[model samples]
Target chain A: MTAANGNVRLAARSLAPAVLVMGKGGVGKTTVAAALATLEAETHGLAVLVEFGDGESGRRALGPTHKGVEHVVIHAAEAIQRGATPLFGSATMAKLALGNFAMRPLLKAAPAIRELAMLESVRQIVEARPGVRVVVDMPATGHAVAWLRTAKQGREFLGSGPMFELCDRVARELVAPGRASIIVVTLPERLVLEETLELCESIALDPGLEVARIVVNRVPLPLAQECLVDARALAQGGGALAQPAAALVSLLEARAAASAGAVAALEVFAHGPHAIWQVPLAPVDPSARDVARWLRAEGAA
Target chain B: MKDPRVIVCAGGGGVGKTTTSAALSVALAARGYRTLIVTIDPARRLAGAMGVPITDVVTPVPLPAARGRLWALMPDPRRSMGTFLDFLFADEPEAKARMLTNNLYLGLADAAAGVHELVAMNLVARAATEGDFDVVVIDTAPSRHAIDFVTYPARLAALLGGRTVAWLAGLAQRSGGATATAPRGLLSWGTGHVEHLLARVTGPNLVRDTANLFADLALVRERFVALTRRASELLLGERVAYALVAAPTAAARDDVLFLAARLEKLGRRPRAIVLNRADTQAAPWVRALREGHGVAPSITEVLDVLEQERRTRATAADALAVELRSKLSWAAVVRLPYVEASAPEDIVAALSTELDAHLTALLPDAR
Candidate 1:
């Protein structure tokens, strides 16, 4: 890894036309994507924000800070609601009617429709703000793989249509170099790191999309060296009860150390320059205030 | 108990099946029916959508609702499986306890060994048959093997101890039978391996019991087959309506179509389609901004922004509508607008509008 400021930047024109954020759940993919959007919108003065494939986790996370940026959350049901109108009613009443009539049935009827609909939403946002950057807080590894693979499946099954076109475009966007960067977010854990590497392979990460970086979130820093030594020695001379407690502390320290190693291995796997910023685990669930502060700092950075 | 029936929701993963089950149960309750949704997804996401934490046991509490009660339950499969084993092997509690703690059982059970699907299906069938709620909706696991949970018992009945098997056993057991003196066949070798493995793992009594369980499997299979037919009737019955839940993406649509086609093959078509997170335009009066740089500061930026927003809304709207029109013609198509929160009230409200749309669509002739 290079010094923070030495971070390799994607060439604007040559970069992939999109950015893909890959990670396990709760490793702050949404937070980082939101932060990137915050940075783009505030510092760069670009119209930008993150997009989510399903539900509204991303939108909710970015809601308060979505000032200059547009946070577009897409799903099939939402798309249909936007499409319908009152033939003989007010917009409110018409939406109410159509929301139940035209949209709801459509929502329940198809799974591919939801994904295709979301892609369409992404396309819409991109076309709307061509110059604006889009940070997608993409689905978890398994779901994201399914989402990415949909394009190949579509080309085979759906033949040609708007849906197929959108899938092809998204696939091209994903594969195109410098157009997009796949930032794999993870915590320093054997399972998470292993999964990250596996995800890279499953998603065809190597030699295709440049993995921009790996962000290991919520890592607890080790205690002082003396404290760790004391803890380890005490652990060795322990009674049964004391051993568990001492072992726990040792385990935690080992985990923190291993997290760094995991990051190093990722650097080798990526074969590209990356950044590793240590995020301390929150003491409590983040209130909106905490999120706002974090957002502010990220924006400034 | 006005329309006491169950809606067993099943499908592949990442298809929004969980969300659909949650919303539909809420919708039925909103229409004045006491409803419950039982979810078996490992993520326990249904509770997140409902704004509550789920416990293992049944605990019905009133939600902020539309004059009716809706309850949600999420069962931990490991716990459920343990409880079930305790019940099934009541005579062998010590062995059951050991099995629960053993590494092999842990691996096998966690691998789910297809047992999660079996247990989930069994629970749903049992719950539906033994419920007082106006409706019971089941959200199954995402595996394609999920189908086997509902259909396997009958499928394996022949292998289980059927009457034919009983006759064959009786014929084989005949004293001085020619086969008894004959050389061992492939079937005997396979049974010998099965017997040896069963003895090593579960002991002679358990092996016998398991053999008996297989013998009784014919009964279990018959019961499951009957229950499946009953479930189909209950779901497709006029009082109950099956809705296929999907996102509007190509993959999600294809999954739904796959599920719908499967259901059609089973003669159990869904009654409606609930499409979540439909992309709608910002109100016409809302001011929009441009993204890129341009020198002349032309009106093109303003027009371009408006044009983009219009196109975004139009593209999403047209895509799902065309799918619904072409494919799910018999079903009502309800589209839910995206809300920026996972709060239950927010989801319920958004979903309620979609449900209302479905009702309107279903009653189209009324208009």
Candidate 2:
């Protein structure tokens, strides 16, 4: 790659055992998570792609999983049941309580139940599958924050119960350095970048949960200044190409200006150990293999 | 054609729903209608786009050029439950005091996604009633389950209005915070067994707190019911309009379809589908350059790449529009060109102008 490409080489050790891919909606969190899972599974022994909520995006992006990679969709209700089965001391009793109609609304309305359950489910998977990298496709920005903080909230709420112990275990795992890290994905747009910076600040407030990397997706390729000058000159020469040339110049100029602003913002925000990577704009949606190939070509492994 | 007093912009994240909501509100205000834009997203995007500081309180937006006035209510998610409680318990100070101090309630306030959504809807209801706005635009959260918040009002009302809550409240009253002992009542046979199982799973402390919280809430159940009823009416009313925002990407298309299906299942159809950034503005220009004699060889490679990218984007967008049109024939599908502005305000202003032209089609009676 040319020096102009500016792709950072991420060491393999930098990849945490648990990588939570998060960002604003529509910023390709699923794509990044899937790609990361594919890369990890191929490089390492096995990797699990974990998806929250509906969980279809991760599977769709990953497509048919190759050997050594697994996909699992986690729903709150099922997670809660799994968590309760151990707590209640019997599977049948857990089912009875959860199945009770009177308990349904109460459980649904209870605060942090979904978040705690999801974390508990993840904790179980990590505990059960040793030496497996877990890549989570987290929810959008706002809810994802809540999900990350659920362990703390659960401990405070439950105080001294079996559930509180579960929360403690999950919280410890999350705060363990080099064990869990966050990969924030964002676009190069002005507003998206601002939101991403704010999200990073919020995440930093939680100690031990590191912002390992920031991947700026869909950054347009920089156009040569001389080419733009030539286009402007061509536009000034009034002809059929004038309007088209002017439009092209304006479009390219606007895009370049926007990209420059994003670059400047990232420069100001760049600090500490977390690296910021930029993925150039692609013509179509990238598959997991494509992303893995791109990262490998960049020497990110 | 009837004019909608409420417009709800719903879609997945990063589809420009907040920007579209702000622009639509600006356009509505420009057309001489007093408008209030309420954003449920905690991301502060609307505030950034409008260049105004928005909080839980309704703040007037200084749209000096518009014929009518504009206001915004962007509730802080952290403080939404508190604000909502203050509103719900405006008259019942004792109940509010009790519930605020309750550990369960405190936990709920911190981690309850449902509370934030309900609080946002409640704030919108309060704004519409108290502000005397001609139209209110709601910018929903960026999630497939964003539409699920529409059911929160009814679901909460039902939960609070149910006999179970009354029984729980009665149990708390009899037991006086001691949930370990069973209180004898008509519903004891069924509830006693369920309570035992619940306590086994969630612990006695949680059960006690739940009972205490319900008892405090029982004092203001009537007000909660009334507030939720009003919010539900405003959301599910005939004059409410649903606008689904989408981009050209396959992810955005799926989000739009999913949201549309969710809305349809709720018996509310989308009134308009906003295809944001669905067109390449320079496509025609690039086509002309390719078709005509491009005498400049220096920029030939750049032009070729631009033309190919434009064709790819155009083809994808065209296919998306066709599929959406066929799937949702009832909703008016409006395409918004990609605004070539970097600043958030500039983008909003440009899209507002575009939306102004298509407002009538989107909102049939928008004059």
Candidate 3:
């Protein structure tokens, strides 16, 4: 794990084939991943960004495609339909339609098995579509663990089988350094930081993947020391609410310190080269254009 | 089975079951019925929705409505397992030890996905059969696992019986004994390990005297049958109404349909569908302001778009309502406006109003 700057430099130069953007749900992983792919496409003129997941959140976030950047949204269910063909080739397309009549009961019988089948189907896509930057908006933490563990499950259940062999190989390739990079997006909050660090540790254990950097979204802007002092004095030198002014200042200072502590904790836990970028919460929902501008200005992507 | 004393809500993960359960329990309790909401998801979502800090212990919390008292508890399978072991062994140390040491027993208990449901069901059964709450509403795991949860004990018992039935029957034939002996070698060793574990956990006399606990298949079969039937009745009874919850998205609507069909197969009928974030036509004035931007070709086109939006909402709501009514003897449609905030108060209040008319008849005093 290089320093955050070094890793970013490495990523910019090498531009790994597969990048998995992962985080706890609702932490702006989708936004950041889309921005990264869009920026890479615009700046260096990449051909396309293949977004994989149930939500197709990246495709939604990135908006319509442009000349340099074409977005291919691969829904897992659709991918499952495609992948099941080679295995269940004799079956009709209707039989393989993800939630169709024939497949529904079998899929429901064992959920873990269904998930494994879907993931392998995904791996098949990754195998076919080479030489492109594919960004997987991986499921949130718990399900991400489940996704990674699918190979282990396959090995256990179908030892020496082709499905098991392929899953194991794909799992090996994914966890390998330089093959894939994992970006852990999180808010600069204590619990989120802890989970992010735990995730990093799990990735570290894999030996194939690297914790690229931590993008801390929705951070509050800093107040200058002089500005705060002036505000304190003005409040103290005031009207009917003057008496409680000192207490209010103390509360505000505590909150400010807590926010600072969150960032510091992330820096400490993120031992590898890690960039801590923050996005100020806009009063109104930020437009995709505005979000892109902020990303570039903040040097997040 | 009309107006059965308990309602078990079952569904898959990430669905709005917890929210539905909390809102329903709050609604029922507000109507002056004592209600308990049970859940298992460790997200502490139910607690957060109910405005309680994360705690495993069950405690009553006052809802904002009049005469309302809703208690919430998450299913702790490990603790439930302990209580179940204690109950099975009659609090005897030897019996507890045998169960603990037995490979098959421990494997079935720990390795099985549906065992959590079994233990939780036991707790639910005890509450419904013993506790005083008029209704025990379960916000089940998502529909994917809901069926398994309700049928687990029966399914597991049947599976085990199938595996051992022939051998047990042969042993009964040979020995002229109603209580068939444990099969020899690996099977006997496994059973002995279980017996020893039970003896150590529950006490030696428990193992010696209660050999029939495992040998007599009838006891296990009887409990499973009773639990399955009771749960099925409570879940599917005419009075027990399942509210299919989904946000207003095409994907969600599809999932709700799939979930409703699955639940119906399991004998749990969905009496209503709540479109959680259903979009209503923006005020005509607001639409007029947008249309007046000089971007539109004609008045007809503007009216057509607005008409389309309104018609879509009407059709979606109507479709869901009709589907539910067709499947269930009683059904209604409830639509809630999409709110930007994810606050509990907003969700609770929104759902409460939608449920107002449907829940009126089911209030405790009505019974």
TM-score of each: 0.47, 0.88, 0.56
DockQ of 3: 0.05
What's the i-RMS of each model? Answer: 25.6, 3.0, 16.6
The global C-alpha lDDT for each of the candidates, from Candidate 1 onward, is: 0.51, 0.76, 0.54
lDDT of 3 at A223: 36
Task: Give the per-residue lDDT of model 1 (tens digit) for B233-288.
Answer: 44445555456666544445555777778777656767667665554553222222
- Candidate 1 error regions (>4 Å): A1-301, B1-3, B8-17, B66-68, B90-105, B117-131, B142-148, B156-158, B162-240, B279-314, B342-344, B360-367
Write the residue-wise lDDT of candidate 3 on A13-75 in tens digits.
453566777786556666767667765565556634555554445555676654455566666
lDDT, model 1, position B67: 49
- Across A1-301, the per-residue lDDT of candidate 1 in tens digits comes to 2232222223222224456677754456676676556545654466455565452555655655566666666655665343222121245643544343212332342244455446555655665667777777776655565555544454444345433455566556544465566767776654456667777776664335556556666554443454445445545654542443343344445545665666676775554232444444442223323443543432224
Query: What is model 3's C-alpha RMSD?
Result: 12.2
**Model 2 residue B108 distance off true place after TM-score fit, in angstroms:** 2.3
The complex in candidate 2 yields a DockQ of 0.51
What is the overall TM-score of model 2 with all chains considered together?
0.88
State the lDDT of candidate 2 residue by residue for A1-301, as single tens digits: 4432233323545666778889988888888888878877777768898987677787678887556778889998899888888877888888887776667887777747777788778777777787788988887787687777878766777778787888888888754567688888888887788888888888878533667778777788876777788789889999878987887687678779767776677655554443666667776677877876665554432
Interface RMSD of 1: 25.6
Off by over 4 Å in 3: A1-17, A20-130, A137-143, A150-171, A176-301, B1-17, B49-57, B62-68, B77-112, B142-234, B267-269, B277-331, B337-358, B361-367
Stretches off by above 4 angstroms in model 2 are A1-10, A231-250, A257-274, A299-301, B1-4, B29-34, B56-71, B126-134, B163-182, B190-194, B197-202, B280-301
The full ranking of all candidates by DockQ, starting with the best, is: 2, 3, 1
